[model samples]
Target: MVAGILMSLRELRNIYELLFCDGVIVAKDDRRPQSQHPEVQGVTNLQVIQALRSLKSRGYVRESYVWRHHYWYLTDEGIHFLRQYLHLPTDIVPGSLRRVSKATARGRAPVAQSGPIPRPEGQTDRQQYRRIQRLSVDKLTGVELGSKPTPKPG
Candidate 1:
């Protein structure tokens, strides 16, 4: 129980930093291909929700849904809280895809990567799956199990 709470708190902090670095956070979508929308390994969608719920209740974050997607944004309070928590000066506010600071560039993460995204090659179903002919267990080949023979067709 204690470990779970500790993990949740750590996830909450990680999520806070994510929102700090990127102005907005979008909930994970399983409908899309993972390759197209690869998720960061440390946090799962469920954990993001659990952490966001705590932040939302405290007025630190605002939530919205658009085009069947959930988006979370850090409020002013959230920014202030994060800055305070990290002992960062209040002047260093970075927006989405903005460079945080020159001094911290060594530890900075790129907001976006340049270059065309590689698309996966298409494959036919037959190429992906093997077809195996198996006998049906529901009934025998010539007659239904535990049933009298049908009357002769007239």
Candidate 2:
């Protein structure tokens, strides 16, 4: 009975691992790796949806939709589940969740001064936007406009 109740998550391991690493996954942006067969390629977002739904039914993930885009967050149990699947230590911290340095944190925090905000260095009241050169598609494709193609050796 217990075995039947707790279904294996082998097939959904990729989705679980993605959540463990990213904390949260945007359904539209989710993609699985390509398979061995050339024609198989990779699974689309639909596969991600199926995996998420399976995990949700198992109480390992929570789902929310915003602006017609689905979002999934890993639950506490999901972390454990992923760790078990990956054979990782329970205290493993994902790269995305790395701690911020004190200086970086301080720079981002706003000061509580009661005076008016100061202007940034080298900036006047009005800031002009600069127009940078756009990349040329011809250059990108190695086919420069008006350039003669070299003949191949016979």
Candidate 3:
């Protein structure tokens, strides 16, 4: 029973990623080492497709046609569900959730911020969203710091 629930939750997380990212461009966005392909490696396009089908049953995600490829996005209900799950501020609607691939000398489990604790059966979507958000914030913070404040020319 626990395993079944966990499986469902994993699918849910995948759906969220697809929806949040506005559907990963199958032919563009070549930033990762695995970006140049029919699908990104490690990220597993099949897993994402499976998750999309599963979440379609829940009516939270929908597919759209853009030229020759399909795009994914959250329905209003889906967005609402994410907001509730993440306990986000009433005014904080997420813009997007892009995936980041860190090239570790060896694969390491990426650390993330603590959010709403999981339901023991491994409800990982909220946690994963928090993790993604934290990473984005950290990246932006680094960029901000790395950039010079500005030239104080007299």
Candidate 4:
């Protein structure tokens, strides 16, 4: 599910880049030729419309009509989303696509050390197993097996 969402977001980002960079105006018709823009190269008109609709629902794109034809363009929110997606600072315009900053890069968060986790002193595997066994069995019966007194249930 997550992978699908990511793939869709990537496709949407590509479509946004094509529209913004190439000044391509997408129409409502699916019969139109695929985009020639490098970012959206080979992508069908239907796929582009779907991406646009998704973006529109997320407030990233807006639709306008001229005469009887519908056209799509990026909203301010859409531009902001694209900027953040590209890891470029909010202040920087996307016109210079090559320019990016390392501080705001969308890299993975820093992971903690990968060394073996330390166990509490005096609690070996055998002790831990016995503890778990006692809890699991005693809780169900309200008494520890082999014990003389019954535990009061709360």
Candidate 5:
């Protein structure tokens, strides 16, 4: 049950990332990874629906239906949560450097007063989601993710 929940959360996070980065969610007909629309590649239509439902239940996403298709967008609360989830601080008011510096001195990381977080090694959201999926599969199969398999002595 926990594994299933974790997988669902992973899917939810992927969906949130897609909306946050791409500003929209639409499952492509082709499920190939090399598709032009990387956002929907390798993501099933059912997975998209499930993720959207989870986000909607948490009030983080809103959906619109038109012509038998569903469109998804992040709510304000969703944007706030995404910022925090990405470790981009959103609470730094202007002219608060003194307090920020004090907090830093006390060992807390200084919050960025503005601007997006610096890109770290340029890893895309798709790559991150794939990594998470790999880890979850590894956990479920009792194999250590990112670890070398032990060799048997001949």
Candidate 6:
């Protein structure tokens, strides 16, 4: 249980940095579809953002922006707490993305490359719905849910 929590904390740390930085250093570069940022070895920027928001709500960081998008940046208290918990250097910058894994055969993460291609925005809601339904998972009782998930049909 402790191990799981620690792992989650690390994930939150990575995400907090990623979102606060706005995909500038950790997210994939738009021009080079072939190149990915070095911070998260296998995880996508979206996953990191989600984890950060989850941690934020629990007060591990600060407010979530509460999904408000009005403000970001770790509180002084939060930075202090996180520095101790994550054992980070005192001068750590806001936009840093630490690579947690080694490169793959293609020099990018195998897992990151495994997801389906992104759909164009012009796709209709019904088409998007069907695509999501096709990817839906069975509801499991022990799992926690994210707030304001991209809604799906019940």
- Evaluated with lDDT, which candidate comes out highest? 1
| Cα lDDT listed for each candidate | 0.63, 0.62, 0.54, 0.62, 0.62, 0.49
Residue pairs that clash (backbone atoms under 3 angstroms), model 5: none
lDDT of 6 by residue, 22-88 (tens): 3222233232334433566545444444455554565545432333232334655556665675666
lDDT of 6 at 122: 85
Q: For model 5, how does the per-residue alpha-carbon lDDT over 1-154 read when each residue is reduced to its tens digit? A: 1212334555556666667775567654443434443464444565666666676778877888776567777777777777777655666222211244566768988766886445458778778778778888988988877678889999
Q: Residue by residue across 1-154, what tens digits does model 3's lDDT show?
A: 1212333555445445445545323323233433323533344444455555555668877766566544566777877777776555656554544344663424766668698665546547777787677779878876443456767799
Ten residues in sequence with the least summed lDDT for candidate 5: 92-101
Runs off by more than 4 Å, candidate 5: 1-11, 28-38, 89-154
Question: Using TM-score as the measure, what is the rank order of every candidate, best first?
Answer: 1, 2, 4, 5, 3, 6
Q: In angstroms, how far off is 18's CA in candidate 4? A: 1.3
RMSD in Å for model 2: 12.8
**Residue pairs in clash, model 2:** none
* TM-score of every candidate: 0.49, 0.49, 0.38, 0.43, 0.43, 0.31
Give the deviation of candidate 4 from the true structure as CA RMSD: 15.6
- Indicate the residue-level lDDT of 69 in model 4: 49
Better of 1 and 3 by TM-score: 1
* TM-score of model 4 (CA atoms): 0.43
Better of 3 and 4 by TM-score: 4
Off by over 4 Å in 2: 1-11, 29-41, 95-98, 101-154
Which pairs of residues collide in candidate 4? none
Q: In TM-score terms, which candidate is top?
A: 1
